[model samples]
Target: MASNRPAPESPYTTAVFSEDGAERSVGEWNPTAETVRPVRGRHRHRVMKQRGGFARSSTVLGVGVIAAVGAGGIATAQNKPAIAISLPDVDSLPGVGAFMSEDAADGAEADRERTAEYETMGLAAQEAQPTAAEALRSRILEQAEDQQAGAAEAARAAAERDAAEKAAAAAEKAEKEAEAKAEAEREAERKAKEKAKAEAKERAEQKAKEKAAAEAEAKRAAQLAGSYALPTSSYTITATYGQSGSMWSSGQHTGLDFAAPAGTPVKAVGGGTVKSAGWSGSYGYRIVLQLSDGTEVSYAHLSSMTVGAGQQVSTGETIGRVGSTGNSSGDHLHLEVMTPGGSAMDPMAWLRSKNLNP
Candidate 1:
């Protein structure tokens, strides 16, 4: 038979057992049935309370048990906290350490990348410069502008010089032309004056020649008018040829004398040629006449003879005028007739043939 007794409490769960190979509870044990009891505490306590009639141990023994429990709690606290330290869940603590180390390396690599980027930017700034293309374009444009200005100035100066030269040439040409024209006009005027002078000289010479011819004709007409006039009406024969006289260049009278008035007109006894008619010695203003038949007549002692030698006379024309001249005793005409050889002849007889008595 089994007495109904309470089963002891087990200090360890593994120490508890069941009949069917399954874990059982503390109440399953019975003393009267001879079932074993589970022990309560593995550590002993000296200072303990009496359960039925057993004596409790000393306090010192209880203190030894408490000391052992306290040692175990300290050892557990050293191992880990009761709550366990929170971290990334992993199989190995060394692997966690390695992960942290890898994170540090990544941060270092990022720093290095940032530093390199900054250095590269600095290098690019140093290498950069202005573009040659833009600078060259600026220089070329400036030079081109300067050249254009220079060329324009040169062109203007050249134009002005050319215009001045053209003007000078034109002026010179005009001056030369004017001089030529003036010279031509002067030459023309000089030739005209010379021609006029020559024409005037020719007209003057013609007038002089005509005037000389007219004077010669007038003299001839006057001689012809005097030739036909009659002699004086009467006269006295004072001296005869071959008669002796006191006033004579010859030993005797060589001519007859007809006494008349001082200004009586002398006439020709017959038609004859006046061989000599002018002044002579001992017979002033005398005239000598020659007949066609070779008879000679002498008339002297006259105031003047109207006819010259080589002049023809008519019958009874005045030969001379009676005057007292050149050894004449009185105013009278001396007349005589002679042969061809100058021998004196009687003039009274020659006068009777013309119906005139001397």
Candidate 2:
């Protein structure tokens, strides 16, 4: 009987025996018509189909790897975040589903899901990048602030300069005013001094004129005193010429009468030569004098005569003494004046004309 158990497995050998008893290593084995097997049936067909599907799945995976690498390079060149591309599940590829086992299909589907999650993460990173417009706005704000500060500084400088100029102008004006005031004061002082000098000079000239006039008057008085003298001292005129009186021999008095004490001295009336000195019938001792102008003066009724006829006598010389020696009632002297024509004139008037008021 044949054992019901399964046959033992053949061991692996590298040798084969030939029918003529010749041995040969498997490495030198060659297929002949009798040894070559022909495969057939549905099992063979299934194996061929599996090989084709595997080749198609491998090609699809290579295409997906190339696409992912190209996208990563582009993202790097643009300075953007890395991006992930989700590959399609290998079991879903054409002809690949037939070759893959149930477990392989499930793993490929999980890898696809993971790739999509990474792609979402890359999109979020790209959204966070700063834009060109935001950077430009920040730079514009900084420039505006700088310009505002510069404008403020310029305004402050301008104000200070204006203030300094105004101050200088004011100072100059004040200086000019002070100079004008000083000049005016000096002019006033000069004018006042000039006026005072003029006044002083006028006063001095007036005083000189008055002094000259006084000196001239004094000289005139001296000349008149020298040329004439009073006839007698201490005498009073008792009668005048052309008067009516009982003591006069003529109807009207022809001479002036000077009444005095008995011994009063008589003087020459003016400077002249003595014409006559003697006693007459009606006239007591008397003297007659002849002046330079041919006029004659007579002193009568004297007690005694000191000058005689033809004797030269000067003014103010004692000629006689008073007495009642002529037709007189008392001790007196008669004074007579006779012009060059022998006409009798009033002696008192004649004496006054000679600047001698007696």
Candidate 3:
């Protein structure tokens, strides 16, 4: 809307309009009249900064200059709507209006107003955006979460590795223990086997010793049963058994006599022990042999006794030498046989029974 007011008289004049109201005056501005739209507030520089009004003004001015130049040469004599431009206290310039049509001029004014409105809306939209601090804080929180996640992953991996190592160590220890136990068992078994074998061998040795002793005893008994020997090597019968003579202690001769050289070896009749060997009253130095079966034989008138009391003699083993020393007429051995009861027996019969010709 346009207004009219009566002013005091001065040399300066302001914008004026004609009655049809399409033509108006803008002073010493671009021919498009767009410069006037920037007069929005007292804080004009601040408003221009917020809205980017200067940049829009420059773009609009450039387009206006180009359009005016193109239309300048084509200005026909046609009567277009009038647009007036002026300086203060000066008359309006109508010549500049010849280059642009009324429609173009009006469209330029509308575009300028729409552009300002659009710039205002753009500023409001910019104010609605998030501030820089809020964006920075969100980025920082996101980065912190990423770092925490990475640390958790690393810790989990470390824990898993530790558990694996422990498990492996436990398994190895168990295996070693098992091996040691098995080795101990094997050693015990080997020792047991060795002990048993040693015991068996010892038992076998003892049995062998007992068997050998029994066999030796049997052989000794056999030899004693089959073997007997004459008392001297060579001799002649001097006194017959049962002969009546004062030489006998009994009423008859008590023994048989063999006359032989002095110092003749007297042999045992069988395997026996010498029961006595020494001097007697009438028998001189005598040796009495007791057989294994408890028979006793005596060799009297010995020059020297070869065996001692309790000495063992086999068959044909020398017991004494033949000589006459007491109650003897010459060098002779008086051989006598007796029973276990100390009574004399027939020496001839006894010698004959033992397979002796003497």
The runs of at least 3 residues in candidate 2 whose Cα sits more than 4 Å from the true structure, single-residue gaps closed, are: 1-226
* TM-scores of all predicted structures: 0.35, 0.37, 0.51
Against the true structure, candidate 1 has what lDDT? Answer: 0.60
lDDT per residue as tens, model 2, 76-163: 4445444444545454555444434443445445544655554455444344333433455578887888888888888889889988
TM-score, structure 2 vs. true:
0.37
The RMSD of every model to the true structure, in order and in angstroms, is 32.5, 21.4, 16.2
Cα lDDT tens digits for candidate 1, 113-189? 65456444533432321233345657888899889888989998999999999999999999999999999899888
Residue 72's lDDT within candidate 1 is 49
Q: Clashing residue pairs, candidate 1?
A: 3-32, 266-318, 266-319, 266-320, 267-317, 267-318, 267-319, 268-317
lDDT of 2 at 44: 36
lDDT of candidates 1 onward, in order: 0.60, 0.72, 0.72
